[model samples]
Target chain A: MKHLLSASDLTRDDAVSLLDTAAELASVTDRAVKKLPTLRGRTVANLFFEDSTRTRLSFEAAAKRLSADVITFTAKGSSVSKGETLKDTALTLEAMGAQVIVLRHHASGAAQRLAQSGWIEASVINAGDGTHEHPTQALLDAYTLRQHLREGAGDLEGLSVVIVGDILHSRVARSNVALLTTLGARVTLVAPPTLVPVGVQTWPCEVSFDLDEALVGADAVMMLRVQTERMTAAYFPSVHEYSRRYGLDSARAARMPDHAVVLHPGPMNRGMEITAEVADGPRALIVDQVANGVSVRMAVLYHVLSSQEGAP
Target chain B: MSGLANEPAVDRAGEREIVLRDIRLMGDRQAVDIRFADGRIAAIGATAVAEADPQAQILDVAGRIGLPGLVDLHTHLREPGREDAETIETGCQAAALGGYTAVHAMANTQPVADTAGVVEQVWRRGREVGLCDVIPVGAVTIGLSGERLAELAAMAESAARVRVFSDDGICVSDPLLMRRALEYVKAFDGVIAQHAQEPRLTVEAQMNEGALSGELGLTGWPAVAEEAIIARDVLLAEHVRSRLHVCHLSTRGSVEVVRWAKARGIDVTAEVTPHHLMLTEELARSYDPLYKVNPPLRTVDDVHAVREGLADGTIDIVATDHAPHAHEDKDCEWGAGAFGMLGLQTAIGVVAATMVEPGHLTWADVAQRMSVVPARIGRVEGQGRPLAVGEPANMVIIDPDAPWLVSADQMASRSQNTPFVEHTLPASVWATFLRGRPTVLSGALV
Candidate 1:
């Protein structure tokens, strides 16, 4: 794998191999050395055209653990805002010996454009893009799910997952829907009519407006962040009304099966998408999802860089 | 209107008279000879062969199809602003190579061609270039702001004599403004060509709204946004009893609405771009801005509907919508890239590949839809005339058997943003004549 741009680009075997490698790499974090020589001579560049502190730090830590040199470039307080194009930034990174570029931009298809534009020879990893796939995020989420539900085995065959809230604008939901279904999991997306996309029926998942009903038979529930701007955009009437319907409070969590776990991709709105009690509860894997993120990214960087080294 | 000179001053002295031998006119089984004198077709068939001037140039077309030159109802020359993308001279050169005799320049320049000064400048530049006749389209709203109407009467009476008015890049979404513009143009026998898009619905629309858009994570441009405006404008035209033209109609629902309006005799004409006829929304998978355009490329089903619409006369003409953008504007990410493609150089080739070769339209229908009907709708005079005695010799000779590849490097336009690059099309424009003077001959610019 030269680039991890979209979760949908992964085959079933490709996804399983990444997960298994991530699981093996997770053990290295427990060791005192906590380092690998796989990417010792490589350089990884985190090119964040948008403000994403958590994701950039996670990738930075991952590259350090793999013994790869890291260079960080952010759009804030930089020449990018003063009219430096994405092409110029990418070329600069490549000139500085960046073998892999982890890009997070505010525009959809920005990562794909970097990868396919023939402007640079670096492999592109999409940390996140505007309403587009974040393949590594989905990978770490899948790795966390396998650790909790599948006992770190093969695919999550026959497992059911319910993803709730803003499916229309959530890149997390888009990537998860593609990656989870490819692993033989049945995924159901629950959101308001206005929050769901017009073509959600074509996705390989069942869609429901009622979060309570969708949680009944689910083995896991992933809560997506609901931006306050959506309220003013008329996607929903009010935050109170949206919470009353889709929020996974203590009451809504009891509706799920006893074995069902809860997951939320970081920096959560405590009282909005999920209640405070539910986020801090024992069943929630939000904290573990972050820790697993580093390991999964290490696996991705190692895979893409080492595979290219063996090429003629 | 600008006056037409009976005898066009030819750049090359003593080359005004010529004899075209073995040219195949549409609907004729055998080839015939045509003689031109003093910028007009002097004779055809037997008389043309008998009265051939000894000093006139004699060229054999080898039975290639000859028809009146194609007329474009929509083109963006980008002069008066954005000359970095294209100029009147470069655009007219591209048009001549594409088998076009005239093109209606769109009104969305830098200062916006809303007044007599801007429109007249564009017209005069084309006249000075002397390649293809460039007719300036006046903006309905000043600066294309979609607010107050521009000086339509002054522009109509100017040296440009604009007959088509449009704020093409930005739709006149205001219903009252559209109605007023449609009614106001009636005094000058003008048509309001509308770019039908609802602003609120398509805030940042990137691609066609469908399953692919959801999967690709790009913003969806719903078909209803286009159909709703077209539906409302057709009703407005009906209420005012005025002529309306829909520019670059790109949806199946839009085709149905235009068909219904035509059935009701609302005096509306619709045009489909060659890109919409051949390309689809699936190209968005590449995330290349070359395929990105306003009224975005739709599904295969919409392609079939537009083709059927063109075949059955429900759609009136095939306008190029030949928009050119500079490298910086189009070579960036998809969202940041400009929404346009070079079309003036590849119009006939795309038409032949998509319409004629598919059996959706014949050579006769091609001439009507590309030339005669567009001229009639835009009220362009002395062009799109039938090829016969005393008619202006503004026509194109095309070789249907010889197919050529579309390479952006070979195009005359200043921009290399054509979506048809590297595509092998079915027809080739061999030669184009503007008032008996060759602008392009032997597939090269004269």
Candidate 2:
């Protein structure tokens, strides 16, 4: 609970408590004055070593709604470009009294290193690291799933979730697989053989190369964005081929159970991994995931910064 | 070869002649007295007590184990280029402290030791330091670019007398170039030491490719990248009938390949690094750059296999691969950091802890793997000699029962990048002698 660096760090109870807190905080968004005084005197620093506007803005909004002062430091305009190290930047942030650091770095384990390096005392929340984990994204996805599938149930005991597309490079896919499995959900990852990592067999979830087969009994299908940059390395022969093999088009979306929801951590590849029609369709909870992102982040900041002890 | 009056009795004017009393030699239960004088073993016998040499420094070593001086066939001095990281002087000091009488300085320096000039420079600097014999390994390709063969014959004929050629940090990935280099070295009785990494497969490899790498999200360095090259090189060595040395073998598959090649009577020798035998890829979970080395630490299963290979003589030797990098090079993020660790000072202790303590190798086997075999592979002379009368008097006394905590500050290497920091290891090198000169005594560099 000290730092939400990886989704795997959360236990079942820890995950449920964050979801419940997020459920309670979701009510504030409906009010005209959607602000809370929970973190009025605290400060959160968004130290992003990578360019991630969406995640940074989401965390900023969440902190603002909780009344915590926020400071934004981007690698492009900061001393990081001048060769100032992560440790020096962290120490500077500590001097500025940053109670929590929300970091998005290009390196896979930057957030973990920042937390464990003893360079600073601030709690670290991994906004997104290089193909590692985005705990908040997974929490928001879980919150969206719980609101739709479980309704009043606190645990997602028997729900089946299928995650499709570039699982090898998707931090969202990695985080979701970990968090969903920990919540008693059966998760299946569907990707092309090349897109799957070397050790996917060892993950808690089952893996499939066929999207249609994975979609059969799934209550939720999450589509991960196809990174075109990775295409240069020829992970797949062509984009058209990838779309044909793993794309969640309308037909494939319809093949799912009637009550199954479709989720995508945006910005979606409209014509690639997911189609425009399926992304905006009635079964799609993509917009709901973004909204839940704010609430989930608010809950995380509350848990890490507040004086409250133990599970909520 | 005793004495002109102008030449000091020891190598240096202030150096002391020492006689060790009642020290137990490795592989022998009986203790004997050893006398060192005039840069050679003056006498060694059951009755040659310290009382015979009244002026010699006398020490009683009851439980210490005596072994031949270790020789490292693989080490990166980082000199002639990255002196801020390590130099010939500092590296030799580190080697001497690690109980090494000699180390093959790798050829991946700034200008690369491709010519006689560079090789002789490294050789002369080692002599100036006078700690351990630093044999400069000539590059197989000029500037380690893997384009053309270096001046191997000139280097072999120079004052350095280099016999081992390697482009260690960069693989001679071209097959024709590798074959030509192997064939070319045959005239001089030279060996080509290969790094054995396929660059195309390990484009941005950060750690071993397995379940742990997938979970950690770091790029996977597949074992096949190393195995494929080894398999090809062993075959090439067999076809050419030349000697080949594999550097820092880190995979179970690589061990099997070497074992199979040896079974086929191929003229090939392989060395396992101390880090590979003692550490694993699980350490990368911390993402500390200290654990990030080239031919990255592998799984526990690979460690077991390599140890078994060494124990059964399938693997010929243990090399330190003592690579040092500056703080800036290793203090950054894992991807940005350099690919090596400080191994010279901790090599013996690690070997003792991983090999001897596990009953995989005895103290005699330690000497052979760390000393005798490596000396033969690198063609190093006057080193790895047995401890007896008229030997070169190059040896070390290890207190096998003593345990000491490793601290980076205590090491002689210029860079403090040892991964063994804070680890308590059994066995300490009590003293080390190079050509009858005591370079280290009472666990401190003389």
Candidate 3:
């Protein structure tokens, strides 16, 4: 793919190929020398307009592992804070001979604009935009899912996935719903009516307000973090109320089918969206998702930058 | 008025008496000849009168359909402020090119038009341009701050004779202020046009609240934000037994509310903009700020609902809400950009495409919605009159079959921020006459 701006931009074949490539790249992490010469002599710039240490570090590690020279520019303590625009920053990066730009912006469509705006010729990858898609996160989640549920099957057809909590503001939920559905997973979103956007009916997944009902036949249950900042504005009544209704506590986690896995795109609220017991439980794959994030990002950078069309 | 340094001086010294021969009047199949002299329609008949006045100019317009000049109840001529975006002269030229003879200048300008002096200056500027009538809409609030009411009585009685009062860019959200404004306008028989967006409900809203917005990650502007305000305002207007006009009704729920209010015998009138009737929130998918507007473009279902509302008379007229902004305002990121688009030049073509072509409204209905009803709402005199003998000769000759693609570079407006650019639209204004003077002749501004 020329760019990874949205998870919806990936087709079934493209998603699977990226997952398989990530699986192959994951092996390098176990080796003494965890470096590949695939992107040697190439440069990838991480242009972050938002504060995202985890995503930025993951991208940096992924590029270094692939042997690509990396440069990171955070919005804070830079020209970005002095009102330099995305265009100016991108043009400056282009002048410095950067071939690929990984962007995590606060605005929803910053990555899309960076790619289509003709400001620079570099391939753009969206790290995470404002409540928008995080394609790499979805890919890593898919990779982690494939490693467990459909190990060596190379596809995730007929798997049922239930995503619960704060679907309205979760970029992870938006990306996972799109990417997982593309891989033939039947996805159901469970959230409070206020936590769901007005037009959730139009999404591909079935929606339910009841978390227990959605957890019954699910192959995987993904818990999204509930931002407490949104709580002050009355998105929900209180943290306690939200936790009581949607939190994946041990009681609700036990209700899931024995083989069903629990996933949380992390920095999880230990007692909020998920209980400490459930989050530390055997079914939880939060740690694995983070580790796979590096491999998946490497695969994306390799595909987008190593291809002849994307190559400078 | 001297502050209008960039205003184009219109030279009307050479305006001549004209005769249009064999022009098809709207809703009539047979062609007729129309003669104009002394700023009035001297004659209109099947055959041209044998006038011996050698100075009269006669043009043979065989197939063009003539309708009363369009009147826009909503237009933003950013004068007395923000002249870099648009001035009264340029905005009038755009209106003339779009077949509009009169437009109510919105109150949301720099130095908000809340007083008699500002409205009079804007009105005089329109008169100086001589392209179209520019009636200044008085701000319902002091500075459109939704605080104290403006000088509605003074503005209504001033030289500008403002008949429509509005706080268009911002809603007069305070219920007491809205009620007082509605009640105060009743003394002068003025209508209070509401912008109808509850601020709290749409704090950081960037686009329509839907699946696309969720996926795109733009802040969702729920339809209830617009509907709830409209619902409350209509009741306020009803309680006071005063006239209320809803500006740019964009959602299906808002339509249902307006329809309900009208059915209850309340004196409420709502207008849908050309953009709301045709464009949808899907256009925001491209992240282009040109599609950004107040009361953000809704879904396809809302577009159809607004169109149906207009067709069924639940909506009274089609207003352009012709907001103009400079390049810097629209060329930035979608969230940082201003909320508006160029509409004065493309209003008629969009109305024709969305309303007339689909059989939702006949050509005669187009005249009523685009001209007569808007004129009535704004209380504009000598404009949007019937194309009959002795009426003021404010009319437009349209070639409905003529199709043209929109190009912002070629538009007369100062700003090239129209979302309709590159869109092939049906209908074209062949000629526009404002009181016997041709402001637009042969589809070009005079």
Tell me the deviation in Å of residue A292 in model 3: 1.3
Write one digit per residue (lDDT tens) for candidate 1, span B1-446.
Answer: 12353233444446647899999986366899998886788999888868777788889989999989889999999998989999999999999999998999999998899999999899889988989899999999999999999999999999888999999988999999999999999999999999999999999999999888988889999999999999999999999999999999999999999999999999999999999999999999988898999989999999999999999998999999999999988788888999988887788888899989988888888999999999999899888889989998898998998899888898999999999988999999999998888999999999
Lowest-sum lDDT 10-residue window in model 3 chain B: B1-10
Question: For candidate 1, what TM-score does chain B get against the true chain B?
Answer: 0.97
Ranking by TM-score: 1, 2, 3
After the best TM-score superposition of candidate 3, give how far the Cα of residue B329 lies from its true spot, in angstroms: 2.9
TM-score of model 3 relative to the true fold? 0.94
RMSD each, Å: 1.7, 2.7, 3.3
Give the TM-scores of the predictions, in the order they appear.
Answer: 0.98, 0.96, 0.94
Q: Interface RMSD in Å per candidate, to 1 decimal?
A: 0.8, 1.0, 1.4
TM-score of 1: 0.98
Residue by residue across A68-178, what tens digits does model 2's lDDT show? 999999989789888788888888987998989999998899899889877888889999989888889999999999999999349889999999888888899899989
CAPRI-style grade of the A/B interface in model 3:
medium
Models sorted by DockQ, best on top: 1, 2, 3
**Chain A: TM-score in each model:** 0.98, 0.97, 0.97
Regions of model 1 farther than 4 Å from truth: A310-312, B1-15
lDDT of 3 by residue, B1-446 (tens): 31221223444355567889888888578887888876778887843457614678989887789999999999999998999999999999999999998889999999999999999999998888878888999999999988898889999999888999999999989999999989988898999999998999888999988878877888988899999999999888888899999999999999999999999999999999989988898898888788999889988999999999999999999998999999877766677779998888888899889999999998899999989889888887777778887888889889889999999886898888888999988999999988777888889988
